[model samples]
Target: MIKFAYTILYVQDVQRSLEFYETVFGFTRKFITPDNSYGELITGDTTLSFAAHDLAKSNLKDGFMKSSNDNKPFAMEIAFSTDNVEALYEQAIKAGAIAEKPAEYKPHGQTVAYVRDLDGFLVEICTPME
Candidate 1:
């Protein structure tokens, strides 16, 4: 059976990205490479991972767009479901995530907010859909 396992974000600093997620989302470290080129977090069934930009480049022959705080975030986002969207959103901002939008209730009955991670990747803080 096919199963979704993990999502790895290419980042300039794998260690720094791992620490940001740990500090803001409270996910524990699973493992990191000896060279600090890659790391994973214990984020439930689907692990959240990070890989150093150089490592990522080596894996992909054509190269890829690198995330940056100076650029607008990409269209996609990684979402974290929580009971307290507001609190988590606040904590993310305090941990160096740029606020893209404040927490607000959606017409569909979910509370959602948006932020950009240190690497400029979009992140969604939201309540579970009932």
Candidate 2:
């Protein structure tokens, strides 16, 4: 059976992206290439990887859409599960995340909020459904 191992985000700076995830979400930096072109975070079962924009360009012939400093964020998002949405949302903002929405409860029994990361990638902070 095929299993999901990781997801890579093409970023302008690998180290910076890794650090942002570390500071904002408490994820630990797992490894980074010596040239700083690739990195990953220790995010439990599925690894969150990052690749430098230049490296990504070299790897792809047709190129891929990516979130950028000047452009609007991509449609998709990465969601993180949390228990204390309010506190963690505030903490994420204080850590330099741009708040897109404050936490709110859904009929499904989940408290969810949205934020943009340093590179303008959408991130969702939400509580688990009971």
Candidate 3:
């Protein structure tokens, strides 16, 4: 049987990324490696993890494209569900996130907004559909 356990994002600073997610998304830290090279958060069903860039390089011989400090965000995005999209969107922006799109009603009866995290990762904050 196959089941999704977690998703790891390669970041320059594992602790920093972990803190940002904790502050912005209210996710609690599950644990961080003793070396501080990797960390994970308790994000509902699937775990959200972050690994240092050096750790990623050691894991992937071919290397991977990471979100740049000055370049635009990557095409992919991580979506988070919330009951109050507007409030959460505002909170995210205030927490050093860049607003990509303001909250708006969708045809599917969902309120959705977009923002870019400190690492230039696209994040979609939305309310669940009926």
Question: How much lDDT does each candidate structure score?
Answer: 0.96, 0.88, 0.90
lDDT by residue (4-121, candidate 2, tens digit) is 9998898888988898899878999999999999999998889999999889989999988878646777878888898999888898888778888999999888999988877788
Candidate 1, residues 1-130, lDDT tens digits: the string is 9999999999989999999999999999999999999999999999999999999999999999998889988878999999999999999999999999999999999999999999999999999999
**lDDT (10s digit) by residue, model 3, range 53-95:** 8999999989999886477878788999999999999998998
Say what the RMSD of model 3 is.
Answer: 1.2
- Between prediction 1 and prediction 3, the one with superior TM-score is 1
Residue clash pairs of candidate 3: none
Question: Candidate 2 — what's its lDDT?
Answer: 0.88
User: What's each prediction's TM-score?
Assistant: 0.98, 0.93, 0.94
* Worst ten in a row by lDDT for model 1: 67-76
Candidate 3 similarity to native, TM-score: 0.94
Error of 2 at 39 (Å): 0.4
Q: What is the C-alpha RMSD of each candidate to the true structure, in Å?
A: 0.6, 1.3, 1.2
- Give residue 125's lDDT in candidate 2 (0 to 100): 95
**Total backbone clashes of candidate 3, pairs 3 or more residues apart or in separate chains:** 0
